[model samples]
Target: MNTVTRPRILVVGAGFAGVECVRRLERKLSPDEADVTLVTPFAYQLYLPLLPQVASGVLTPQSIAVSLRRSKKYRTRIIPGGAIGVDLKSKVCVIRTITDQIVDEPYDYIVLAPGSITRTFDIPGLTDHAFGMKTLAEAAYIRDHVIAQLDLADASQDPVERASRLQFVVVGGGYAGTETAACLQRLTHAAVKRYPRLDPSLIKWHLIDIAPKLMPELGEKLGSSAQEILRRRGIEISLGTSIAKAGPEEVTFTDGRVIPTRTLIWTAGVVASPLIATLGAETVKGRLAVAPEMNLPGEDGVFALGDSAAVPDLAKGDGAMCPPTAQHALRQGRHVADNVIASLRAQTMKPYVHKDLGLVVDLGGTDAVSKPLGIELRGLPAQAVARGYHWSALRTNVAKTRVMTNWLLNAVAGDDFVRTGFQARKAARLKDFEYTDAYLTPEQVRARVEGARAPE
Candidate 1:
């Protein structure tokens, strides 16, 4: 008697699109239909939009991190690793496990959604000096770092050193940079009140971006409103500016203005995962090129989405691709799963079209700007809309409850501004987290796989 081998479905990354895809596939596909697997270092899907809150102590890290195994709908076999390379022709994916073991995973169907890394330029001392906001660890590290600055400044006698320690320079005017600057600044403000000896006026935050306007996607009125709110809070907004050089204690702006600060948070932009380069496929703006159906052009049983895929935007209907946003990535994930199942069942696959959902920029506290459903809102109303949207988008009820509870507790009791001593405990630099040189070459992948199978 011979048993029929089930089709293997492997998914890369646990980001917004990758998590959604695995969830949908797990729900739709039966055990006999396919065996699903997911490759990721962590078993949780990070709610990236609220990372700033984590750094600001508004929300705990665990509150925003949705566990993958929490739901009973999960049926996929999770592999604790990150993809290093892909052999498209051989239907194989090479993954670097948490233990540093290289394993080759074979699949009949594959979904590439390895997400993105913080895009950095060749600015001097950037990798060694700057902090990042892309991961939970980074947020936690930043929280401790920001609070530590206050501690050190309070203990210091030198006025120049205190001023430098009190200053923070945030690069990028996009959502992450803007929100991070706003949230962390609020943290410092509430924190400085605790130190009677430290001058509150010495604490300064400079928000600089190459773009002329802040959050241009939020439209003119909403963008201006956010800028005004931040400006009113004493934030220095330097428009049409970028970092020329990043140093240990200073960052020189492109406009030749030098800022002396130990904190340099880079939230400029993101590039597609280095995994995209392994496929050696065409890309649109650093992302893997995919059809409107979220499948590779001529590659059989392979699909890509999220920040790594340049999925065509049919709703725009002008040869445009979907922007790398959670809204688009989640929707695309569901659609790709449907298409994959449709393909297996010999049914028609549908194209992924995204409708405009406007934008939201939470400036911490009651200050926020939103253009939900094309209606511009500001202050408390916008904050409500923004938080409501994010809260509703969380995958689990437990996560929502924790986040809401955090908000309530923060409102009633406020923060203690305690530094967990992560600065001396760990290296929280940009290079320490995102290693640009970590990916494996194609030859190295083949050698490792062949060597592993040699014993057989």
Candidate 2:
């Protein structure tokens, strides 16, 4: 390899994968050897596993948001923006800043770890009414919005309005939906005591999914256990059902049940970042196809991983791809970085093979479920495994300390049902956060890269 200046390495997305990749690159290579730049909408890597706690007010946003610049490798340039387009042929990446400025950044090598966004469908009124729990702002907004519902219900004399305000419909019984319903249900259960005028039974939480069970990843036994716990707490668990129609005040399920509720949380699933489609590459299951070494075949100086890329599940040996998870993302990020460094030095690169560690679901309170190293656990034991995994996943000590402190404080302190009125100014909607409408066509991408025409 021959070069006058150091290779400019551009990493898209400051998520678990992207952050770990940059950190590894920073540690392995000096600034004089290779320049590293990261593009992300935020300066912090969100500890997404803890986002439910944030939505429940158990943990503050800052506690789960790990800082990017605090690492020992401080030379990496942080570009606070999201990648809108990538011109692989010209080796230029187009970025849209937080302020909406479009800029083109040239890179000698690029890492695509753009993570994911909430998956939504064509359900009527879904975008305008439903809330999401993917981002930090969404979690905080949800916390405020849920509390606001209780406050509004307490003050309103109209039973109709009060009933609607107290009921919450959370669609999708995956980990996010399950944990969200569980945690927030506990919040309202403990909170209704403050509202002496309000009927406790009016506060209802419905966890619905098209799937047959709750958190099937936790396995059947634990999944059944989670369902029983939620049922005991009076949470209406509806399986094999999804939102047929959604409105500001009510949601109609596919099973012909119309539920009145002011709050609707959509956690059905997540698709790869829209940026992944801009590359005009073949994808496997909505994710960019990548080699086990995390490199794009036939394309030099390019790598993709995390939820955005279909990383082969080498450990499974079943022609399968690694599941989109924080655990896999963290490992992929670190391994991809090492592979990138090897490419820079013209050295041999190794394939990424990771076995599944386990799964954990914090149902809030003392109840939880986990499967660590194939051993199923429930109750207190599961809670420890769940928390221990999250605590260790946090990159910085500051984040760990804050999260631990928040956990301790929340356990000891009594519930304070206060609404910040976040939704009063502007209701939290699905469309506001992730820009699902933004994406470039294959023709547009080819034109941009080939210099046939400017990207729109």
Each prediction's Cα lDDT score?
0.91, 0.90
Candidate 2: segments with Cα more than 4 A from true spot:
1-3, 71-73, 446-456
Instruction: State how far residue 314 of model 2 sits from its true place (Å).
Output: 0.8
Supply candidate 2's per-residue lDDT for 422: 69
Model 2 TM-score on a 0 to 1 scale: 0.97
Clashing pairs in 2: none
Candidate 1 per-residue lDDT, tens place, 307-369, comes to 999998898888988999999989988989999999888898899987979788888889999
Candidate 1 off by > 4 Å: 442-456
**lDDT per residue as tens, model 2, 1-456:** 885887999999988899999889988897789889999888998999889999988998899888876666388998988888888888888888889876778999999999999998988999999999899999989999999888888889899999999999999999999999999999999998888999999999999999988888888899999999999999999999999999989999999999999999999999999888888889997899999999999999999999999999999987999999999999999999999999999999999999999999999988999999999999999999999889988898899899999899988995566667766787769899888666666567566556644565
lDDT of 1 at 297: 86
